[model samples]
Target: MRSDQPNYDVDPTILQPPGTPVWVADEAWRELARAAARLDRAVVVVDCYPGVDEQAVKASLERVFDVVVSVPDEAARPTEEIDALVAANLGDDRVFGYITQFNVADLYDEARLAELRRRVHERTGPIVLMGWGARLAAPDADVLVLADMPRWEHQLRMRAGMPNWRCKNGDEDILRKYKRSFFVEWRMADRHKQPLLDALDYLLDTTISADEARLITGDTFRSALDAAITRPFRFVPYFDPGVWGGHWMQEVLGLPGDVPNYAWGFDCVPEENSLALDIDGVRVEMPSQNLVLRKPIELMGPGTFARFGADFPIRFDFLDTFGGGNLSLQVHPLTGYIQEKFGMKYTQDESYYLLDVGDDGGVYLGRKPGADFDEMFDELEKAQRGEGSFPDERFINRFNARKHDHVLIPAGTVHCSTRNTMVLEISATSYIFTFKMWDWDRVGLDGKPRPVHLDHARANVQWDRDTDWVTSNLINRIDVLEQGDGYRIERTGLHELEYIETVRHWFSVPTLRDTQSTVHVLNLVEGRAAVVESPTGAFEPYEVHYAETFIVPAHVGEYTIRPADGAGECATLTAHVRGTEFPRSVSGEDLRFSGRSAS
Candidate 1:
């Protein structure tokens, strides 16, 4: 049975080395004071991610040091200058923004930074420098600390009237704020943070409220990130409601009913999700991207890591539309388009694997036979200008869907899932790049019109993919690969042009599997529950219930999966990059994972 509360935490008890101290609440502040006592004149730099409570960090540091300096406030460029600088990248669009290549130091005033440096050198006792770009003020420090927060947490704080790093636009539109973060601030912050994380002495979890916070030594924190990829693990999942949301997740996952409906279940978005690391007894939550950035080879394997360094290519998420409205008609950019336009290496080439289908569940896919492209574009432009409503049926074809149906949706393909269908979207990680052609005349839950990118859609939509071509190419393109006693395997595709390969496995008995030197994502599509464990008892057995997505890291080279006792006929849908392969060795003992094997 599906557990209301699923497991996404990674403990790595056996793998963890001793002497990792976890300081919480008041103890966290005290530990910094204790560390400062060791130095004659301590220069502790608390480098922060934007949107973290810089004031609270400064207040806490004052309890440890004689004085705390806000580096960004003292030396950073004015809010207006920062805004004007990024205006070109932010663009005039309500949804899209081109990625900027500027570094965080670009926003700092060099004269002010030099002046702040002179003042800091004049101090005698312990000093604390706190703000987004504190490290820029003092490259060499007695102790370095990172006050961290994730992108999603930043979004929550923004919606609650919190502004960006140095801006006073607290009452700005949430989408505009997000666009700036995604296109401007986040890219710059990440570029600034990568080197700091490697040389850090401490990491403070600033996402938590002021009453109770978590802190750990950088060694212990880095060790935990290394320990995570040695076995199977999952990132913490987050859910959100939309105008076209559904009731399945709210009921099945036992989510709060306060929201109108649950539109998305973010199971494996590394950039936006977090991971809770168990350090002895305390829970330390950190962004999953930290692991991706730190250990790209072990987590993604050499194959995918070579193609996309520090970028998590594969993504899995849930789209719940049951008893709600249809998703907006959308198309994603092709790889060349994404690379040239947005500075991304790839695009959102995705597939919808139907997990649950209600009576009226279906999808709008491909163009109708002999549909006039010019006429459709004209109608879309007219609808955007409020001249008339878009007639979707005039251009698109509707296909009835069923449970366990897998449909491939490569970039440039026109597609949209309808109401009453639960979709598990297995795709590339760049989901934010989707260009909406129409929104079905529906407004968002906030009573605002969702932004449509008809111009971008016009440049990318595949006009060649007609109804007949879709039937032959994208829908239910399954091939029987292998079968044995109490086991069967089939290749469920993501198309030839797409890089991701998918397969479905059904087994009542224990089935041995190999990771093929690459990361693999799986969801329990059928039966009640199943357990994934090391083949030679390397890692502890991990249980997954129905509809829960789990990841098998590339370092876990070999593993086994079987239905739990009392559960029957379990099945899983697996996804991975296409070219990652490891030929079976001819002889010798199996190379199972161990605590000693972890980095």
Candidate 2:
């Protein structure tokens, strides 16, 4: 089965939430009821996405309040019309509360939203503005309830036509339209929603079944929200299949083998991933962006947050090609190019750290020295037009792979992970800007030729990054930084183009480390398992296994890592922003290694 196809048979019970507190449906309803009873005229606004059961909430409110009025009887209306209707209904003497839907999808005009907010505010009675853009319009609402769903689930629901708000187009057209609108819509929505998170009176996770929906409110919600932003966290990994996907993940990761192939696994992409929160034995998933919006400073630290507002600077994911074909020969736009072209703050600067590989595994990186670029592109055009095959080896340099080999791929550098390799990609979080130059002359899983971006690739490719330069600078460069009683730390890679630095620790005993106010991304690259513990009990200890990635929040201050029981020696690779002050380091440590030189 292709990954893009809907799998309705997937068991909901398999979902396990992150250990946290979330208010169950009954508890949330009861709490809202009690609040409603205490107020003579309370304006409770419930802002949510499509498919949320607003009627159920209205029913819940009606059980406590004498009169509840749902405004703008029409499901969809223009902002001006909605404003007029809301204004006309506001002064009604019999109505105790007004529940109005303010879907952002219907309105893109900021001025119109402002006008609607002004009209809604004029009402003396309590107003319950429900929908996505309500929070942005009514920032000063007495009570704000943010209803959210996991983006993946939302997409599924949309595909299933579960929401009353329907797109006029067919499913295929709907999917195409969504794909085109996703980046812009999500960016705008996030910008408007993030600043209002701290003001939220309640957060409702609507990803679960209607009967099992969960909410987090009051102090418990605050605490849970804090934990989400300021702790070692993980996102529910989402797997997808591509034309060049492989069966390695299906075999090694124990994923369902029914799919054609598993190409990409989004381990911690907050933008596209969801947070699964464990609430009273029930699993509830919410958009991971809520964490960034709620507490950017806590998650990213002060300096990093200041530099890249709510955006998570670093990204960690897997790129598997085992038993499949090579990834497209690609180049990411330069920082300036990306910012000017795509309105992105940062460019995608990536590195491939080989985790596992077949006997003949290799990677295509850099350009061969003295390669004829004009002639190469002319041949590429021919290959793209189905006239001939691309001479890949002639234009690109190939390097044999080994476990734990780090291959640096900064922005503007042309590269791709070849067949029979599983690579852990760590880089800046500006994903989805790849310019593919070649795709092995294969069609997509849909049997269509994948779009090629030769013009874009040609504009960005760093021609000077020849084979010799790649051999000298882009390969594994390690330096022994310090060695203690039972632990040794080595500085792995700190390319001039990268803002983050990586270090590997080979330890046999418990090792203490401090964040120094900079977040650290850790992976147990070797050994069975390791436990990260907080000495002062500031946060709960978390266990990670081989190849599993975890984060250490900057505010955690100090933590300790030790091998799990019965596990002997272990190796963990820690990556963090450059220029962070370390708690301890040896001044004059041996920097030389046998296979690679530190310098």
Candidate 3:
């Protein structure tokens, strides 16, 4: 079971030695070496060793590994010891690699630590640590352990206080009583090492995909595809959708696993296509809703908007086999800059009316005051990469989304639907938004990847935004005074950044408010309503649909709408411009009124 060779998952309790000068205890060292043997990999213990029983431990570990031990003697140079182990183990195809433990705290001064890294990396193959020496000596080295540092250090005090800081709060006594230590042991070899590395490097440097290179750029499609599917690609599941009865992802997309939703733009989906794109909004739907949600529209070429818009602009298909699971996350463009910069077809402004959830499910929203953006982002980068500290406060503002609970998510807000929650999403016509942060770093079953938008998200993040411990400061507690049978306005705050006001009536209602030229995206979150053209006007139900959206085409005259039922409440959310910079339009005039124009 040695990781250097091949075996099952390694036991983690071997990290702390049993007896020592707060160093490698005999018992702990044996456990670690035992776990390494189980991994079929020789272990590398990088430490200033004194308490470890080298003779007894070596005999036990040798039984499992073709062991090349590197415990630098006082006279032996660290480089020489490393070279000997590397040459011995790497040369013998049958032998698993070495278990290296250097008293780095004393053996190497700063100069020697640097020298050790250069020499060690020169040795072929991956390296694992028995202790935390490499992180201090060579902070950037690709190192892995079963668990994170157990406690907060004075140096990490600032981050430790931050909510998003990956600072673990656990005691050794508590861990010892438990069966396993936090340390991890897994295979670290790449079957196609050189190819995977080269492909990753190329992807980091290039923007064009494989097919685009042949027609326009010189990008090799075969190479990129090969890189994407390389084995040893890590898979971590943040949450299990299928096991949770109903999941948030399936609910929001309004999909039934057996029956396809035609509005999602797909016709007669194949059985194989079911499992791949089952989650929603993906071409690869799978039977399990545990599908990855990744969109590479940014990499798509120009004129993509025109072509995509002609078909389904904000297209997504999802299956809710069992029902009662929904999602609760809303999105909006950062500031009307999306279409202006990236283009119209690339904005994601949507909302959710969560319908159902298991008793435990709830949505986690924006960061708390303690979890600052910079701190959260840093911890996320490290934790996701399995490199830095671990954030203890991975869950925040997670609330249950009962049926009919309406949440309007504008751009810049952080949110996610929990594992078991069903919700409806009413959104803008343009569908290009992203979750800037994620508490979990698990990838899905896709050999491909779940894309993270840490870079593009910067433009949309509201840095100074804060919320009450319970809800956002923007959640307006307005006093709704009924105006008339055909009119009611629920004055809600988009706050200073956005606005959400609900206009309702029996069937036909008229209001004389000045347009101020701000274009509004109107959607029927409840009963269906229509904007009937005035007598002698061009289009009836101008920008009308029962699906989800309609625009208050600027300069349209006093309009009338009869609800489908004609006498019941007809509701629509009026998403209007928020800042002083947006233009204003007078009623009945079309001059300065421009809304969602094509880029």
Which is the leading candidate under lDDT? 1
Per-residue C-alpha lDDT of model 2 across residues 476-498, encoded as one tens digit per residue: 98788778677888887857888
Clash count, one per candidate: 0, 2, 66
Model 2 CA lDDT for position 270: 75
The most accurate candidate by TM-score is: 1
Candidate 3 — which residues are off by over 4 angstroms? Answer: 1-362, 372-375, 386-395, 401-411, 419-436, 439-445, 454-463, 469-472, 476-482, 499-520, 528-547, 576-599
Query: TM-score order of candidates, best first?
Result: 1, 2, 3
What does each candidate score in C-alpha RMSD?
3.7, 8.7, 22.2
Candidate 2 lDDT score relative to the true structure: 0.69
Model 2 CA deviation exceeding 4 Å by range: 1-34, 49-127, 136-139, 155-182, 209-211, 228-231, 580-599
Worst 10-residue lDDT window for candidate 3 reads: 181-190
Task: Please give the range of 10 consecutive residues that has the lowest summed lDDT in model 2.
Answer: 590-599
Q: After superposition, how far is residue 489 of candidate 3 from its true place, in Å?
A: 1.9
Q: Compared with the true structure, what per-residue lDDT tens digits does model 1 show for residues 1-599?
A: 23445333222222344456889988998898889898988888999987788888888777757888999889989888988888888888877788898889889999999999998899888888989999999999889999888777888999999987788789988888898889898888888888887899999997776447788899887888877888887788888888889987876666678988999988888888888766666777778888888888899989999889988888889899989989999999999999888877889999999988887898999999989999999999898888889999899999999999999999999999999989999999895898988888888877888889988899999999999999999999988776777878888998998999998988888777778789988988887778888867788888887787888989888888888898889889989899876655514533221111111
